[model samples]
Target: MPIRTEAWPQGTPCWIDCQVDDPAKAGEFYAELFGWEIQDGGPESGGYLMAAKSGAAAAGIGPKPEPMAGSPSVWTTYFAVDDADASAEAVARAGGRLVVPAFDVMEFGRMFVAADPTGAVFAVWQARGHNGAAWYSEHGGYVWNELHTHDFDAAKKFYRDIFGYTYTDFDLGDEKYVTFTPPARTESVGGISDDSAARGEPAAYWLTWFQFDDVDAGAKRATELGGTVLQPPTDSPVGRSTLITAPQGEVFGIIDPSKRVGEMPAPTS
Candidate 1:
C-alpha cells in the first residue's frame, strides 16, 4: 500500500472529487462499486462525503452548489501546491484564469480552481491540517490523471509555466501525447493528450483514472449499478481499462494495473 502521512509532492495530482446533483445517491453508487466507506463532512461542509478505502481517504463526492445545479456532473482533479495564493498568482502570469480565488477550507487547507489556456478546469491545493488522499495508485484509489485538450501545445506551455514541468513525448501513432515531470522529479506525474481532430470535438477536461482489481468485472458492475460503459474494456499500454459514466453522469476511467500487456510487464513476472 502506498500511503501518505503528509502532502504529495508539489505539482502532482493530490486529490479528486466529483460534483453531482445528489451526493447521497452518488455516494452509494461508489460505495458499492469500490467497497468504500462513505463518511459525511456534516452541515459545516455542505454534506460532502469522503469515500474511504481501508480507513484511508480515497476520493470525494459532493453536491453541486447552487450556481452549478443541473450542470453535467464531472470529476475535478487537484494539483498539490505549496501555497494556494502563490499558485493563483502564477496561474494569472501563465495565461490561466482562476475560476475560484484562493480560499481557506476551515483548517483543512487552502484551495483555488482555475482553467488552463485550453479551457480545462483544474484546482490547486495547499494542504494544512488535511493532507489530500491517504493512499493512491492502488485498487479503489486513483492511479493516474490525464488532460484531454484541443490545443495540446498550449496546454503544456501553461502548466509548464505554472509547475515548472518538463515533458516526455510519446508518438502514440496518431497525434502525439506527452507526460509531464514536475521540477526535480524523474517520474512523470500526468499526461497531456492531443485530440484536436477527435470526432466529437470534446470539451477539455481532466480525466481521473482509478484502479480496479478486475477491469472487465468493474465495467459489468458499473452497468448493473445504472452506470454506462462509454468504452468497453481494452488493453492499452497503461493497463486493461474502460471508460465509464457513473449513474450521476460523472466520467472517469478504470484500470487494473496488474493486467498489463505488451512490453510493460512487471520485472518479477
Candidate 2:
C-alpha cells in the first residue's frame, strides 16, 4: 500500500470536495446513498458538512458557489500538492486557466480553483492542519479520476508537464482510452481520452469514478437514491462501470474494476 503519503511530489491529489446548493439536502442525499455520516464541520469552516465513512473522512459537501445560484449542483475535485502556488503556476504554463488564486483556509490548508486546458474545472490543495479526506476508494470514497476532453494530445501534454503524469494508451477495440499513471507502481490515478471519441458528447470535462464493492448494487442504489443513470452498468476490458448524475445533475461514474481495489491510485494529471 504505497499510496502517496502526505509528503510526495509537490502536487499530488490528496482530496476532493464539492459545493452544493442545499448543504442539508446534499448531506441527506449522500448519507442515504453512500451510507456516509454527514455532520457539521464547524463555524470556522463555514458550517461545511464533512462526509465520513466509519468515522473516517471520505469527501466533503459545502455550499455552492454564488455564481451557481440556480444552476444544477456539481462536485469540485481537489488534488494534493506541496505548494498551491507552484501548482497554479504550472497550470498557467501548461495553458490552463486559473479560476481562483491560491488562498489560505485558516489552518486547514491552502487551496485554489482552476480549469484544465480543455476548460474542465478542478481544485488544488496544500494541506497544513488538514491533509485530505481520511477514507478512500474502497468504500464510498473516490476510486478514480479521469479527464474527458476535446483535445487528447494537448490535454495529455498539459497534465504530463503539470503533474508529472505518465501516459499509457489502453485499446478497447472499437474505441480506446488512455490511462494516467502516477510516479510509482501503485494503482494508476485516473484516465483521459477525447470526449467526442469516448462518448460522442461535445462537452469536455473531467470525470471522477467512485469505487464500489458491487457495481450492480451501486447502480441500483444510485437510482433508488434520486440519481439518474447516464450509462447503465456495463463491463469493459478495463472494468465494469455505470454512469450516473447526482440529484443536481452533475455527472460521474462508478467502477468495479477487474483488479481488486488497492492502495491510493495515482493521478492522471
Candidate 3:
C-alpha cells in the first residue's frame, strides 16, 4: 500500500490540500471519487477535514481563508523542510515573496506560504506530530506535482536555489519539460514547464495530480458531478491523464499509470 510513516526528505513535496468555499461539498465529492473518509477536525480547527484513504491521512479540505474571498478555489502543494524559518529566508533570498510568514500549526508543524519569482505559490512545512500525508503514489493518492510558469529560467533558478533540486530535461518534440528531484534523491518529485502560452495565461500556478484506476472514468465522473473537464483523457509517455476543475472551481489532474510507467530522463546537470 506504500503507507508513509516517516517524514519525507527536505524539499520534497509532502502534503497537499484544497481551500474552497464549501468544505462539506468538496469533502463529499472527493470521498466518492477517491473512496476517502473525511475526518472533521472540529470547530477550533476552522472546519478543516482530513481526507483519509484506508484509514490513513491522504489530503485535506478546508474552508478558504477570509482574506482570500472571491478568489479562485485552488489546491496548494507543500514542500518539506527541516526549518520553516530558514526556508522562508532562503525563499526571500531567491527573490521569492512570502504570502504568509512562518508560523506553528498547533503541534502538527510549522509552515509558511511563498510565491516563487514566477508567481507560483507554494508552501513549506516543518513536521512535528504530523509528518504530512501518510500515503502516496497509489490509486486514489497523489502521484505528481508540477509548476507551470511563464518565466522558465527564473522559476528554475529560484526553486533550485531554495530546495537544492536537480533537473532532468525532456525534449517532447515541440515542447520541453524538466523533472526535478530533491538533492540526493533519484525519484523525480515534480516538474516544471513553460506552459503559460498554451493556456493563454501569464500567471504561474502549481498543478496537483492524483492517481486513478481509470482516467476516462474519472473524467466522466467529474463532469457528472458538476465539474468541468478542462482536458479530455489523453495518453502521454507516462500515463493517461486529464485536467479538471472541481464543482467548486479548484483545478487538479488525474492519471492512470496502468499502461506505461515512463522512464524519466537522466539529470541534465
RMSD (Cα, Å) for all candidates, in order, is 3.0, 4.2, 1.8
Tens-digit lDDT track for model 3 on 104-211?
A: 888899999888988888999899999998979887889899998878889999999999998889866455689899996888899998774576674799999999
Count residue pairs with overlapping backbones in model 1.
Answer: 0
- lDDT agreement with native, every candidate: 0.89, 0.74, 0.89
Task: Candidate 2: list runs displaced more than 4 Å.
Answer: 1-11, 67-71, 184-187, 198-202, 258-269
Candidate 1: tens digits of C-alpha lDDT, residues 1-269: 98878888889999999999889999999999999999999899987899998899998899876656777998999999998998899999999998778889889999998989998999888999888998688988998999999999899899999999988887766777888899857898898989887878566889999999999999999999999999999997678999999998899999998887776423221
Q: Model 3 — TM-score against the truth?
A: 0.95
Backbone clash pairs for candidate 3 read none
TM-score of each: 0.95, 0.86, 0.95
Candidate 2 local lDDT, residue 163: 80
Scored against the true structure, residue 165 in model 2 reaches a CA lDDT of 80
Q: Compared with the true structure, what per-residue lDDT tens digits does model 2 show for residues 1-269? A: 12323533443456776677778887887787778999896787786888888877788888865544675566777877878898889999889888778899898889888888777888888888877866776758887777777777888888888888877776544444787666753555677776655555746676777777788888788788888888888766557888988886777787877644334333333
